[model samples]
Target chain A: MSLHHQIRQYLLDQAQMHGWLAHAKIPSERELQTKFHASRITIRDGLTKLESQGFIYRVNRKGWFISPPRLLWDPCHRVNFYQQARDQGMQPETEVVSVNPLYDAPLIRHQFGMDYGNNLELLRLRRLDGRPVMVERIYLRQTDFPGLAQQPLDGSITELFANKYQVQINHESSHILVCGTQSEEAALLGIPEGTACLHIERKRYDANDRLVDYNLEYWRQDALELKVSSRK
Target chain B: MSLHHQIRQYLLDQAQMHGWLAHAKIPSERELQTKFHASRITIRDGLTKLESQGFIYRVNRKGWFISPPRLLWDPCHRVNFYQQARDQGMQPETEVVSVNPLYDAPLIRHQFGMDYGNNLELLRLRRLDGRPVMVERIYLRQTDFPGLAQQPLDGSITELFANKYQVQINHESSHILVCGTQSEEAALLGIPEGTACLHIERKRYDANDRLVDYNLEYWRQDALELKVSSRK
Candidate 1:
């Protein structure tokens, strides 16, 4: 094996033996170069190989760190994001990117069984333990929940719909697809363009069997573990 | 946009407007070169871009073809592979790669509540409409179903277990992860190395709720659409 490959193997062994926790910063490139008696480029090549293999990740302007274990997601449950992350012992946060009245969104209209100009579009960024994991765009019929746009948009929208509007989401139908990430999604997730992502579209209905929300979520592939159980 | 990008956009427009069906062969490189009045290199580059975007794929000795629409899979149903594909209007076939008695498979033993040297391993390749889509490795307890290795093993193993052993799979717990495809997986699926694929691990239980099988499936990302419905 080449020297850099040998160095990569050594570092990988260290990671395994030291129980390097997720997101824990590894030794700097200079430190690795010094220890391995290699040049900067050789050390960099090794790290790059590791990153591409999902063993590590680099944050811009920050040092390299171990990639975190994926978050387990149970789609069959109605638990909101906050509760789900907390249950898994991870800190979760949501930021409202934007909310506006959607016009002429044909797909959303068709999903909600509504005409154009009747839905409010909400875009939010969701993070787990301070790492961006998903970007969600939700469209809801404006008449379904009055004054919804004026309310605080952070935290669980599901809880808000249930508590304030007394509209419980009774059912959800989700479609999951794997596709290349768009530039906008890559920007939001801080990943390169053309990275693979899980694109999930969900149609949510209330107790009356009326479509209340249409949601589109793009998740970082490395950040989630989806779980489902089926019984007959 | 660059010349190749413009060509890519033009081809994409044709794909959208012409109603090019899935798996339908697009024009050849020579034809594209003549039609677009572009250099051969530019045309090749454009096609390469489209392939990487999952808009198209190349079959060795055959020309480039449009990717098929994703197969919608609902895990709630206990339908076997053949039945599921047939229900979706696609032909499904399975090839048994190999089957052997497993020894010292700690994970399989733990999952099946068995000691070491008690499991049988079956490797199978699944194809949809004559195209390779998934590779499955199933580990089952040898004591649970004797003489399974000597069976035909071409069709559904679930059916075999039901007919011969009267073992009905009652429940399935699945874990879904998205990661770069391994070398062996890429070769089986006939895709480039490191392509994104959905890795699903399922633990199946019999009617008495005993763990009967542990299955690992690697699905080509572009060929599947997973669906789930949640109810309160």
Candidate 2:
């Protein structure tokens, strides 16, 4: 094995023994360099390997830390983001950035099968374990859920639809892609602009086969690797 | 819209009308700067936007080019790569790198439900329109397909299995991820190492519901953004 590989294995073994938690800082670069008797470049190469494999992540000017395990998301499942994170042992928080009535959105209009009417637009920021993980822009037909603005918005929209409106979502479809983080999303997610993100365009249908909502979500790619399948 | 946005739109509109093919180089940076009457940085920002959206890809020394459209791959689908690409209006080619018999592979051994026996390992490169798109390392049970080494391996292995070996695949499951390119894979895919890649691990089962094969595949993230759906 190369020196770099040895350095990677050393850090990994130590991390395992340390029972490393998410965002737990690792040793400094100089520390690794002195301990391994290797150059800074060699230590960085080893750290790069760990980052690529999703074992650890580097925060600019902060240091390297243990990465949170990926949250398994199933579009077909009824579970929402808050519930999913809770099930995975992460504290999930939702910050409702904005919700307003919009009369003109071409794509959402087409998806909702609307000819003329208004839709509610929602910009939400979601965090897991105090780290910003995703931002979602959701669109829903305003008339479908009247008085939606009266409901508490900083929570799972899925649960809101289910319990408050008695609207059950029976079908969903997701289109996943790799996308660059634009400036606004960059600020909200605390990542640099143009970072790769796991972009998911999801649509939900009611039991009557009516389109209930559609959302474009961008998830931070540093730690999450969503393994999606067609069935259980 | 920003000047960069205008430049990106200009190039995109032109590509659509021109029927841009994969690897078709766009205008040089200088040319774009002159045409847009913008600074080189502005021109590059536009190009970066296009690249991030999977509309174009860059070569190390060569300029940017229109990226090939992403292939829609379904693990639940019975179609193979060669067939799927062909059906999607692409000239697909497969190169069999090597096939070696291995006695010890812990992961493959577990996937195959085997306590004892050797596995045949295959390394293959697949291309779309002469561009290296994916490289797969496959592992199969040696006893499952006797005389597999003698079979013609350059084309579709699925065809070979059905016709020559009388083995038909009925099921497959895939685990997808985002990974960074390593040095060796970078050379094969003709991209810089540490480039983000879409990685997939797939397992195949025969009609008898026995695990027949397992493979790890790395896809260049330049142009392709696979949209996976879980249903028919």
lDDT on C-alpha atoms for all candidate structures: 0.79, 0.76
| Structural RMSD, model 1 | 4.4
Please give, as one word, the docking class of candidate 1. medium
Query: Which candidate ranks first by TM-score, i.e. highest?
Result: 1
Q: What's the TM-score of every candidate structure?
A: 0.85, 0.81
* Each candidate's DockQ: 0.49, 0.33
Off by over 4 Å in 2: A1-21, A26-64, A230-232, B1-22, B26-55, B60-63, B230-232
Q: Tell me the deviation in Å of residue B72 in model 1.
A: 0.9
- Give the Cα-based TM-score of candidate 1 against the true structure: 0.85
Give the per-residue lDDT of model 2 (tens digit) for A1-232: 7665676678678878988767889899999989989888778766755664566766666788877788766554446777878888989999988898987778778887744479899999998898888899999988878999888999888888989889977777777777777888877887556656778888887777788888888987664666554332
Top lDDT model: 1
Give the CA lDDT, 0 to 100, for residue A151 in model 1: 90
